[model samples]
Target chain A: MILTVTLNTALDVTYRVDRLRPHGSNRVRAKAERAGGKGVNVARVLRALGREAVVTGFAGGTAGAALRRELAEAGLPERLLPIAGETRRTVAVVDESAGDTTLLLEPGPTVPAEDWERMLHHLGRLLPGAAAVVLSGSLPPGVPEDAYGRLVRLAHDHGVPAVVDADGAALRAALAAGPDLVKPNADELAAATGLADPAAAAAALLDGGAAAVVASLGPDGLIASTPQGSWRARPPRPLAGNPTGAGDAAVAALTLGLVDATPWPQRLAEAVALSAAAVRAPLAGDFDPDVHRRLRPLVDVRPLHPPRSA
Target chain B: MILTVTLNTALDVTYRVDRLRPHGSNRVRAKAERAGGKGVNVARVLRALGREAVVTGFAGGTAGAALRRELAEAGLPERLLPIAGETRRTVAVVDESAGDTTLLLEPGPTVPAEDWERMLHHLGRLLPGAAAVVLSGSLPPGVPEDAYGRLVRLAHDHGVPAVVDADGAALRAALAAGPDLVKPNADELAAATGLADPAAAAAALLDGGAAAVVASLGPDGLIASTPQGSWRARPPRPLAGNPTGAGDAAVAALTLGLVDATPWPQRLAEAVALSAAAVRAPLAGDFDPDVHRRLRPLVDVRPLHPPRSA
Candidate 1:
């Protein structure tokens, strides 16, 4: 089973309104609530793809209770550490008329030092039996920048592969521990490598210590680099809809590929096809089975030059 | 016992922040939640002043649960009618530096017609036992403008004194029922009567059908007009603090006075003194007992000619 970590969990609230007026009272026509965090999104996508995924993180207070209840209702396995403060809430105002969305995001509750240490200690206990672990999303306050790096080293010590999905300092810090795979979108890769080209950025990350680096190009699909081979895969065309969690879908496919020992080319092709299918799903982290089946045949995988070892 | 009705109930969330930047994310340093509606605030103050206040109206969903839990925690009795939708939440960002507040209020959930009838029916059962019934706050959707009017008539039908603490059509409609008293702040009174002068506005409302009118003039104290007499009662002075719920405190004092048979001159003095004390109590209701006692002696209550009989 895949284990995922999300330090900053939120109760996501979406309100459907006819129009949004600043500083004006609104009567929300419809409202929905869901548990949210990057790793939680990844776990949800894995579940949608028929894979077993367990979520672990710090959840607290009433909002935390609501989150756990929602996870139970959604049938997701979770082992959340209770903290002292309430979990945060993020609000999204969806104005369907003009097709523009305005988001009001809350930066969640601050995690205490003891809570952060407890989460790491919890990860130490769970890593041994897990085949692969995912360390994702922003680190809440009190968790150091090298947190993901520490988790990566712990996973390596336990003989478990770790997939790191983050950006900025946390992503840069995780590379020295040699994660099995690192997924950064084109812009994030550019920021990490100080290179403008996506292909060159992926090469720099692989050289830095990642066993394989998959550069997600969003609408252009994905470019994968590994020790044995490198490949570029593209969907027939860009899928239409909200692309919020398509990358999480790709992470699900990558995790499955590693566990099943699928060839690099086939894994890259599957990841692209699944991601395209995910965009068309109404809610994030879900793929329409029909769309997935229809798009799988259109993914084109081609060999690319392997990066030169230093 | 004093009975208060809150048609549009809200979960009032207070967040402490250094400042408020529109369209930007905010991390609340301090957080608190409470059930809020004008009538609810009145009931809370009454409880603090050692009075039994029974609160009623609509409440629903998880937010409603939170509201009930908070009210119970505060040691106040509640008889909220559970509706299908959750109550609205109003966010107050308090910037301690500037001592200024920005309010983001949501239009409360619309009550269904059947639910409205149930609430009215609940009032019917409770009105007979109340010494005074206080109808306060805005009318939620699906509740008619004449709702307060109908409720006022209900109280009078049972020979109980009724006070209407609302604005616009709801206040206008309630006046037709000739409630014992109507309290409108300077702004509400101005809007309702189209008169900028507080004394003139109070007289206009009294002439319109209300047996009496009490115009709350913020730090200037209160002015009341009855067919028997008219008087102005001003407090000693103002204190340093948030003045958000001062008006509600005034209402609480007035209601308590009427029920306890405190003479009108003393009632006017008590309302002003209690409202001043509320400024010192911050978010919690009830004036500082010592300060209230001290200021009560200084309240200047002088009689004048009543509005010339129409």
Candidate 2:
């Protein structure tokens, strides 16, 4: 079973309104809610792909309880540590007419040092049996800056491959721990390495100690780099829908490939296909199975020249 | 003890932001939440005034549980009956720079007929020891249109006074049931009676068998009509602040006066002072005690002419 860690778990709420007018009352036409965080989303996608996945995170207060209940109802396994502060909620106000979404994200609760320590201790016990450990999402306040790095080291100590999906400093620090894989989207890639070129940024993460780097290039598809080789993968055509969970679907594919020891080209192709399918799904943490099946054989993965020196 | 009924309770959530732009993401600067409904606000204000107030209504689902927990934390007495549908949440997005609020009111979960009957039976047991019953707020879907009228009859059957703070058909129906008092703001008064004149519209309710009619005239204060006499009351000057709960505060005072059998002029004066103080308070269901104390002695209460037609 693969283990996924979301340091800052959230109760994701979506409100659908006929039209969203700023500074005016909006009567929501419908609402939907689910448990969400990057790793949680990855774990859900993994389960959908017929893989065993367990989610672990800090959950507390009423919102946390609600999140846990929803996860259980969805049949997603979770081992959440209790905390004093309430969990944060992320609200997406969807404009039905325009089909646009406006988001309001609350900064997660401040976790105490003791709580972080306890989580680390708990994670140590679970790392040994995990096929791979996926560390994802933003670090909540009060957590050390090198949290992802520490988790990567712990996973490596247990002979478990660690996959880090993060941005900025967290991504930078995790790279230093030599995580087996690091997935950064285009915006996050530039933000972390100050490189305008996705291939160059992915190569930089590899040189910084990550065994492999996968960079999501939005509608342009994905670029990946490793010490042995490099490749670029994209769907036959861009699929348009909610892109919120596409990256998580890619991470799920990458982790499954790591467990199977698949070839780099095949892994990149599968990641692109799954991501395209996820984009077509209405909500995050879910992918259209039919779309995935149809797109899997059509994804184009080809070798790329190593980036020229920075 | 006073019993306040909030047929449609809510978890009132406030999000403070720097500015509000339509169809744009908003980063909330701060957030606050509390249990709220017209009668719930009345019960809270009554408790602040050192009166015994017990709240009862339908509560269910995760939101309802959170609302109950919050009420318990605040030490407000409640005995809400369980229902299948979750309680609604009302979000107020307050733009700090503009000092304006945009409201998003969720249509509450539909109530089944059996749930309404169960609540009525539960309320019957609590009414015997209650000094008065206060029916307030909108009736959730599936409840009968004459819900408040039925409650007023129930209170009279037990020889207890009943106050109805509602609007439109519910107010009209309750007035016909001979509730001891009915409070309607200017807009609600006009909607219920089809008359723009507050005094004349209030007298129409009296003619419909209500013992008294109190009309909240916003910044202009309150005008009250009773079979014995008529009176007008206003604060020394309009209190400028959030007016969200001002009308509920007035209802609290009116209910309190009914329990004490206070004179009409004194009741009107107290209602005006409390309502103004409530306006100065930042949150609903709370009043500025200092403002209430200062305004109470200065409130202007005087005789008024009876309506010409009704």
Candidate 3:
């Protein structure tokens, strides 16, 4: 079974409005909420794909309880640790008329040093039974800057591969700890390496000690730099829908590829297909199965630079 | 002790942003949340004023639990009935640069028929110990339109004065049940009675069967029409701050007057003063006590008409 970590779990809420009016009272026409964070989204996709995945993270207060209850309802197994502060909420106000969304993201709870220590101890225990460990999302305030790096090292100590899905400093710091794989979206890739080209940015991460780097470019598809080879994969047709969970879907596919020791070309193809399928779903952490099945076969994978030796 | 009812309770959340962008992501700099509904706000003020107030109404789901916890934390006694549906949330996004707020109000949980029956039974038990029963705010979907009216009738049956603070159809329906007093802001009065003039609009409500009507006129102050007489009350000077809970503060002061059998002029003066004090406070359920005390004696209450006997 694989393990997914969400250090900054959130109660993701969505509100539908006729047309958003700034500085005015808006009566939400419809509302929806679920437990979310990048790792949680990856775990959701993993479970939906028939892989066993356990969610581990810090949850607390009423919003945390709500998050836990939702995880139970969704049947996503959890090993969440409780804390004193409440979980944060990310609200997406969808404007029906304009067909756009405005987001308000609350800064989640601050983690105490002792709580971080407890989390490290807890991860050590769980690492033994996991096939691979995936660390994802932002670090709440008060957490050490090299949190992912620390977690990556711990997973290694247990002889389990660690996949880091993060951005900015969190993504950069994890490289030295040498995660088996790191996934970053297009913008995050640029932000992390200060490089304009996806391939260059990914190579920089590889040079920094990551075994492989997969960068998701919405609609454009997935580009990967790995030890075995380099490849670019794309779906035959662009799917138009929410792109919120596309990156997580790719991470789930690529992680499965790592566990199964799939070839680089097949792994990149599957990642692109799954990412495209997720875009076809209305909400994050969900995908249209038929879209996945249809797109997977049609995904076009080509050698970007061939094997490093070649 | 006053019994305050908030059938549609809410987790009122506020987010402070540097500036609001209509179709962009906003990182909230600061956040604050409290249990709120018009009735809840009234109860908060009543408690702050050292009045004994017990809150009773329907609350459910996690948000309901949150509301209950806050009420407990604040030490306000409650007899809230539990339900199955989740409570709603109201988000206020404050734009620091714009110096304005945008509100997103969720349609609270829908009440089942059995819950309404259960509430009447619950209120029946509490009325005997109550000096006055205050029914405030909107009725959730599936609740009877005449919910406040039915509540008023129940309070009257137990020889308890019922004060209603609502607007539109809810206010209109409650009037015919003959509540002792109804509080409506100027816009609510216009919406309910279709009269532009504040005093005239209030009179229209009295004709619809209310024993008295109090209309809040924002910074202009308040106007009251009751059995004894009519009067217009104003603060010595206009004060600045959030006006979200001004009306609730007024209702708190007026309900206390009813319990104490204060004269009409003194009651109106106190209501105006308290409302202004609430405007000075940042949150709705709080008031600036110093402001309240300083402004009370200076409130100018001019008789709109001589006592009916005179």
Best-fitting candidate, scored by lDDT: 3
Q: Give Cα distance to truth, residue A294, candidate 1, Å.
A: 6.7
Q: Put the candidates in lDDT order, highest first.
A: 3, 2, 1
lDDT of each: 0.84, 0.91, 0.92
What candidate 3 gets wrong by more than 4 Å, as runs, is none
For model 2, the stretches where C-alpha displacement exceeds 4 angstroms are: A306-310, B306-310
CAPRI level of candidate 1: incorrect
DockQ of 3: 0.89
Q: Could you give candidate 1's per-residue lDDT for residues A146-200 as a string of tens digits?
A: 9889999999999989999999999999998899999999989999999998877
Residue B227 lDDT, candidate 2, scale 0-100: 79
- Please provide, for model 2 over A207-279, each residue's C-alpha lDDT reduced to its tens digit, 9 standing for 90 to 100: 8999999999987789999876889999999988999999999999999999999998899989999999999
Arranged by TM-score, best first: 3, 2, 1
Q: Top model by TM-score, which number? A: 3
lDDT of 2 at B33: 85
DockQ of 1: 0.23
Model 2, residue pairs in steric clash: A22-B22
Best by DockQ: 3
DockQ comparisons of all candidates to the true complex:
0.23, 0.64, 0.89
